[model samples]
Target: LCYFQQGSQSHSVKHYWYTSWPDHKTPDSAQPLLQLMLDVEEDRVESPGRGPVIVHCSAGIGRTGCFIATAIGCQQLKEEGVVDALSIVCQLRVDR
Candidate 1:
């Protein structure tokens, strides 16, 4: 994942990036995607922004949907009282 941050008055510009290999056949080659997410979160907290990332895949919907849903779940957990990622994901899927 890669995000381009257009700086706001409160925060500086930053590039938050992460990569993952989903091919199960090559598990050894699969790097830690969560670690990358953590780094991106740290960067984002250090520097907030307005612009969202341009996310896509070979077939963009499924991959993008999952990614965005997960982010929303985490955000909701922080902002709201949500505790279950799976339940949030279910609601998202139903709405979609």
Candidate 2:
């Protein structure tokens, strides 16, 4: 996956950091690398009038699905004071 910092005025990025995913289950196990990725994303978000983050995998399906689910769950949490994403996904699947 690639991490990028985008400028506000243009769609092109100002800076980027790239890394291969490590065989780690937890973010804590990949502290430095994970932090670097987060920092790049944060920088992009902080750019004035920046557009949405464009995260994509080659297939852009599996990871994209998870990210969309996570974002929806996060918004729901803020709105309804829920505490879990897994539970939300489970409930959504069940409700459907």
Candidate 3:
């Protein structure tokens, strides 16, 4: 956790680094990644006014994309009982 100030206001930023994930490969277990996602989700839900959650990897494509897709897919599944990974990917691409 870290804090910074903009003007006279201060905010917190949390960072979760996964150093074990290889550059182009997935982790052997999804548990740690899933936990991170859940933690982020909970934080967002509990703090509606918080800033966006930023996730990144070394190259900002392979692992980063996978992590984002998984997070969005899981949220969609929870709220809609289904996951549209292709649509999510397309949306993410557009945002990028």
Q: Candidate 3 has what TM-score?
A: 0.84
User: What is the overall TM-score of model 1 with all chains considered together?
Assistant: 0.50
Worst 10 residues of 3 by lDDT: 17-26
TM-score of each: 0.50, 0.42, 0.84
How does candidate 1 score on lDDT? 0.57
Q: Name model 3 segments beyond 4 Å from true.
A: none
Cα RMSD of all models vs. native, in order, equals 5.9, 6.8, 1.7
- lDDT-superior candidate, 2 or 3: 3
On TM-score, the stronger of 2 and 3 is 3
User: Candidate 3 — which pairs collide?
Assistant: none
Candidate ordering by lDDT (highest first): 3, 1, 2
lDDT of 2 by residue, 28-96 (tens): 344554454556557766886766665554465544444446556656766898767778678656744
- Which stretches of model 2 miss by more than 4 angstroms? 1-45, 83-96
Quote the positional error of residue 3 for candidate 2 in Å: 13
- In order, the Cα lDDT scores of the candidates are 0.57, 0.54, 0.87
Q: Is 1 or 3 the stronger prediction by TM-score?
A: 3
Residue 48 alpha-carbon offset, candidate 1, angstroms: 2.0
Clashing pairs in 2: none
